[model samples]
Target chain A: MPLALYTVILTQIHSSNKVVQIFGTINMSVYSSQRIALIGLGTIGISMAALHLSRESNIVDVFDTRPDFEQYIHKTLPIYMSELPSPNTDPRSSPESQPSTSLVASLVSSGRLRIHSTLESACASATIVQEQGPENVDWKQTTWTRIEAVAPSSAHFWTSTSGIAASIQQAKMQDKSRLLVVHPFNPPNIMPLLEIVPAPETSAERVEFAREYFSLPGSRHRPVVIRKEIPGFVGNRLAFALLREACYLVQEDVVDAKDLDTILMASLGPRWAGNGVFESYQYGGGEGGISSFLNKLGGTMQTIWDGQGRINVEGDERTEWKEKVIAQVNEAYGTVSAEQIQIKEARLKDIIGIQMKDYNRHGPEV
Target chain B: MPLALYTVILTQIHSSNKVVQIFGTINMSVYSSQRIALIGLGTIGISMAALHLSRESNIVDVFDTRPDFEQYIHKTLPIYMSELPSPNTDPRSSPESQPSTSLVASLVSSGRLRIHSTLESACASATIVQEQGPENVDWKQTTWTRIEAVAPSSAHFWTSTSGIAASIQQAKMQDKSRLLVVHPFNPPNIMPLLEIVPAPETSAERVEFAREYFSLPGSRHRPVVIRKEIPGFVGNRLAFALLREACYLVQEDVVDAKDLDTILMASLGPRWAGNGVFESYQYGGGEGGISSFLNKLGGTMQTIWDGQGRINVEGDERTEWKEKVIAQVNEAYGTVSAEQIQIKEARLKDIIGIQMKDYNRHGPEV
Candidate 1:
């Protein structure tokens, strides 16, 4: 990574109106107009902060219960920042690595990413409060209540919970409309799947506001507005349903774990990465679109469904399946190594970069 | 797409020997030493022929029930062959298109891709006979019987059936051990997922032989040997399971088709494309590995499983779900236009190319 100075900071407006201003070193240490208070700096919180820092025009006050989180951020957050797709990339096809390490170091030195000892201090004047604390319902309720009391009334409250409905988390809150789940898949800044799941009470205005904020100019994040808060939500439900059958296949000895993955990576992986299921089938239907596809193959789908095994992830079945999967996964690929994980992460980032580039050039829609 | 000629054809040995022998155009039209008889030139047959022809060394004898099949191959086979990843590509990063039209024209003019009026004529003197006839059982049985009677006694008999067990297809044949299901997903040339599903009677030697054949040097195909023939084989079953949950979610009004697709394309697509199911979960499990993941999230998975709704595609529910999906898909994406289809195909190919490049560089194995 080249040494790129943070001498100039530009704040990109999230709407039709574009505003730009220059800040000198005198105000370089000072935060930008947007004060995003990211509470509970675990996976989601740290990642969100890194994303904000990448913009060079935001300030994030972060706090977590863990005492060593500050040090952890110093060590770990740079990796996430570095993996982010290069901004204003000239190449539209392949992903290019950006020199983000020095920029992160500069931001850290300038105190743009402030550390707060108390949650109240973090939420004191936050424009947006993103909470990614423990998954415990009681902890979430209490945390929201506390943050709401300290945070400005106009602050946009966001939770990073995966399964917990925002309505439940906001039950004890005074301003229910302000709170909603802004769940990121994991390592928030890197993976672009930021699901903005609004509770029934969450104002439509805020949902739209979030849609714009997370999807700023040149932003890589793909924020999806899930209409309702179904358990596991849309993404996880889709993933686990596929996984259940995957596990069942392994258990049935139809194919081992590695073979199953090879089959998928070769076929469905690229298919979904490009068009997803419905559109892929639309193509499968030939000129008839998805309608033709359902007519031709829907019956077979039903047969497969009826015959699909229900994997019991609990009790003895879990034990039996686990033994089988672990042995097979280990046997085929052995224990996952850091090199393997690194390569996997690199490829994931590259594909996402390719998608984002297409999204930019072709306005690649859903 | 340089105008690389078939003036020199090389037969690549599909094993450790990696033999390469060049022949002049006088010998090129005569085909390579390995004569592959492709019975039934529909989707699978045309694609398999294209894949084989990509290697100048391969001579595929083709036959189809359709009367206009010869013209169809002249027009359609080029497209499939063109889409196959370029041979000995240097970049190892992005896909580069080749000037394959002239090459295909040359191959056709040279009579390298031979078309037969009868299946017997196509398979009569072949070293390997791959059958991709209609889905009807009787048709498959009759076709196999005819091919087995005329095809060389030692010729490998392979079927491209999706569901029918090899045992059932070979029931009427004398040499049952010689025949098995070597199904390729959709277009065999473009897709690499070739499942070699052998029945109880299929010799282990034959299974290994099929594996070696499909996974030849620099071959794009990734073949998986299914221990047993299961419904939908493996790929379709996994896909339909995911699609089932997808339909259920749409039926419950949890999300529309486009949003469901957006959620998947943004999250699971790249994840699976890069690492696949078990491998992705291995990373998902963090340091403790997949065991830790099952232990931590197994309960939530069970809850999601219990609450999951079954989508019945065989009855009234099919109509209801179909109406909902068709409307939503059309509304969100409009009718799938040819341009849309083209872009989708390009992206899919690009991602697959990226994966293949990684496979080559990292020696990426299942």
Candidate 2:
């Protein structure tokens, strides 16, 4: 289906406000309704469930092969929502904003979000199905084969695997153009980065649709499209590059892990928060701009690049480096507790929330 | 001299409030006085001068070989100060704060900050001198040779060369232990990262002094000591690593320069601003922390690392890549103007100022 036609159908459904029946048992008003199927119940799946439930308007269908799936959702959904920053608690949020608690409650009470025992029922009428079963290619392929049999022909698919290629996962699907990779940073509900990587078989309209849907106003997510289907995409590529150098510094005895973290937290972290590498370099040029910066400091940058470490974390040194790094990390941050993780997440939310507010006010033109 | 004795002498001078003669002519009351000399009046030099003059207490002496040094300072200092967020204008600043205008004027009227005709006059009774001459080894060596003969024996020095090794630059000096590399991120006053890298010959006491002095209360500079000397130190190394990948993406047609900047500004930039890489990964591990993070994702990280690009900007591809990047950057940013540069610097100051305020309120226990 053409995106324009699909959008038109959605608009018509929203405006009609007519009642619709699914499985001849559930009745829902067709007012901006979307049937979103979540095809796993792991950590990432639970976070996605909370995100969808918190919106209160989506019909979220969840499925997992485990027998304890229902119990897991019952036990974990409340905890996930509690960890999320409420508008009332967030300093950046206004008083009149909808609190996450009420939204999740509404979704549950209205039966708009529910768990299903079978994949056939979960994906029966899904307009958008998000698959996050496991990282292994075979497991994903098996799950998708089941999903492809029951999901609506026009339903768009989102694969949440971090490093798996979209092409390999969708190889057996009949409608290959509908499947694309929509990997998120961990704790997807909290962290806003959504890397969209579409395979060559995926349609351009679907990629555009994914980008727009994820970055819609009040979604609280930032979407960036990856032009090529490389492993790890952009975020991890950039992140691991930094981690590689950080490990090198520690291994080389230039600084301990604690001091390295201190250096980054105090310096690069804040600077990067405001400006990325290229922009920072442009500013560093001091009125001369990036051209002058390249002219003067390009040699220095190249020298540093040549000196950067090439340590392999999966190689022979993995055990030693891992032991050293873990020891130092544990020393710096005491035993990891649930409360400590909550505190860290809260701090991250505060930092990112304030930055988003500032970006809305004085961000670069894009 | 021992730090304890140095502190005692400074305390005595402050308590006595006796008149002291500098250069055998100028008489001033010594009350917590620090005579700081600034060499070279280029872009970095001017920012450093504004920072010192804004402090309202430091006696700053400046020198540049160029005959237009005075004119340049006169023309540039006000613009820099005006670009700085004023206490009256910044919502985060207190009402009773001294405005930057008065601070700059007071330094000039009281003869606390003066332009010197020669290096001899500039180094004459200096307690701390910041040298920001061109980033050339031979020029820096010659400049230091001239400065060593006239500077006070106990005076400390800050060599602000970004990539040059401090040992090579200070080889001609008799007291190599007093000089250390103190590289600051561009627009030194605005960006708070002060990388204190000490050479092998540098004294431990001097390194400690440098760390404490730059990070003094109200100094608005965050200092991180480098335990060992390395080219580009930490900030630039990490920065170039990110930039190298960014350029690679553009070169490989994964994304354009504009899209790459957009991706970073939206995702990695904000995340890094709040938490550095290791902490982010730790947080990403959910309940298991860094151990779980590495256990599950270490292989994926290694895969990405192996696939990373190895473009050399100083080698055969330098000209071609440089031309391509400059074109794209120019297309994205338009012609970089002075106004645009000032706007970026001001925005950076705003971001850092607010973050510092937050740190003062609810910072980590470090």
Candidate 3:
């Protein structure tokens, strides 16, 4: 047989799962040779591209609708790359002092990252297609449909929409099993969380493959599987719940936004950083554990929950409240300058680096 | 006037708040000279004593119902003191390697910390009476009454109860204005949170004094004023809200307790460690700020809020669930040994130490 014929036959076999194992574990080593198609040139898209490019040796083909999207990437990619920790550079060096010249140059020089002007070109041979378009139903639906039409039948689709459900986004697709929500927190390149929310039709084999692929040691990403699809998933749901109560406190004049932030930074922040809610309570129970803690404070917990404020953030008064809160926050934080924000992010990265180091030493525990 | 007559006149004038304030600002420098009476030598009491002794030169006279409480302090005080960041000791020293002999010796030899056999002796001249008795309302009430009987008229009372409201706890006191709940997280000596939930009768002057006293530069405690007497205050309310959702997720089997903890350690934990929920969303809004964030995701937030599971930790099913969670937690954390718990605390202290350094340099920003 001709070389092209052999390649086509093998691709068909792989896509049909005739060659891919069904009951046994899939070899994660296949990711090294896989091509990733990144659709959209927004902040998240660029961040995902930069992270994948710098952290892994996989070939990344990026697609965007804008004519000058390549120029935009060239301009913004450096900033995302700068956020990454370089092995050769001193980790403690001032962020401003150390330029990301070598890091960006290395990523470019590797010749593994490419920009495709058309979506069809980007998805032609990709094994993984990560869609990060605007979070609109129509835009996401159209984008996924186009990608699905051109991408290989075996390609796994990861939608990076923060709020949209994977099932809804992939409703029009022919094979829904390959599509899922792979939401990343802000600054996707740095923050380790990658919430993998699989659709109902998403195969267990594919979910396991993604879990292993994203959490592979070299990927530097922590992939959390969300078995059931729910609004905001886990991280944001928990965060917004905390945020709602915080807003209620401010509304009640219990504590100003600044003082409330200080309280969290000093106590709950550090506590949560080491141990999550249940484990913290478990520890809070002392030797008796979570049972003792819940038994002792269950009444107080119930009282607080019952009295928790139900402020309507989407109501007509939201604008007035936002204005008041913004003024108060500005009074406390001064103007939120880009420089100040960058400095804050740097500090956060440093703290997370310390935590990651500790986790590496002592495996993940409360 | 005679020396005795002159002293009596000075005391009366000082109690009247005439001589106490030399100028507009009350002399906070006097806190160094003011003695502290720590009533009840339980775990919290000992932890509070050790922190006060190690962090300040204030004389701490502790009293407990147990006859061998003195020996208990002699043995356990060292461990708590060792957890403190010693200015004289190396920061990188292992927890097991560094002994707190010199630290304890200095506190003892300075004539600053002493064990009192009787409550009256401990409270006779104390300017601050920190009551850390058992959580029982009767025990707290009787303890406070006894301390109030002997403590000086100008002394401030701090109740270290986690669940009981300051108002209910102080209802029987002669002067409620001076009593407030000074709740602290576990390992009080290391964790910096001091949730000051004031009673309705607590004077503004007293509140300001308590705030400054706990958060003063050298005190090494971050005090947040809970302006209203709400159940669980701020920390525990927010904590339990998050805990409820976490438990719900565990119950639903979306993720196991261990995986759920991993998700937090990676995402919400670190994010909140640097920025509280409100500020994080503010940042999440990108340059548009929090208004933008809420406007974009308000609907989704509402959905999450509505769908959030209302878990009843006090219900009968709690026991069964607690057993399952405890088993899972133990499998991950190895039965919660005291030594392991201390190590966890030490790690938290180290993380907080790094954060404190950053905050001191950058100052607190929302």
Best by TM-score: 3
Candidate 2, A109: how far from true, in Å?
A: 3.6
lDDT of 1 by residue, B212-284 (tens): 6777677788989999888789999999999988888888788889888888889888888887788878778
Report the Cα RMSD per candidate. 7.7, 6.1, 6.8
Off by over 4 Å in 1: A1-32, A88-111, A317-319, A359-366, B1-32, B87-111, B317-319, B358-366
Model 3 residue pairs with clashes: none
| Tens-digit per-residue lDDT, A1-366, candidate 1 | 101132122323314344433332322122334678987777677678878777766777888778787667777777666656666643324434544446555676797888778999988978888888888899999889899888888788888898789999999987788887888885455577888999999987678667767877667888888888888888888889989999889998999999999999998887888877887776788777778878888768878999988878897654467789977776766676777765666567777766854522346453
Of candidate 1 chain B, the 10-residue stretch with the lowest lDDT total is B1-10
Output the lDDT of residue A92, model 3.
Answer: 47
Off by over 4 Å in 2: A4-32, A53-57, A65-68, A71-105, A286-288, A317-320, A358-366, B4-32, B53-57, B78-105, B286-288, B317-320, B337-343, B357-366
Tens digit of lDDT per residue, candidate 2, span A1-366? 455565575567657984333223222212345688998878788887777666656789999899887666777776666555555465333424433545445656788876789988999999889988878888877778888898988788899988888899987788888889988876565777788999999998778778877665467777888899987888788888888888788777787777776667666776666566666666666566678888788788888888888888787864466777777776777566665555555555665655554322245532
Rank the models by DockQ, top first: 1, 3, 2
Top candidate on lDDT is 1
> Which TM-score value belongs to model 2?
0.85
Whole-model lDDT values for every prediction: 0.76, 0.73, 0.75
RMSD of 1: 7.7
Which should have the higher DockQ, number 2 or number 3?
A: 3
What TM-score does chain A of model 2 get?
Answer: 0.84
Q: What CAPRI-style quality would you assign to candidate 2?
A: acceptable
User: What tier of docking accuracy does candidate 3 attain?
Assistant: acceptable
Tens digits of lDDT, candidate 3, A75-131:
778777666666445444653464454554565577677778789999998989998
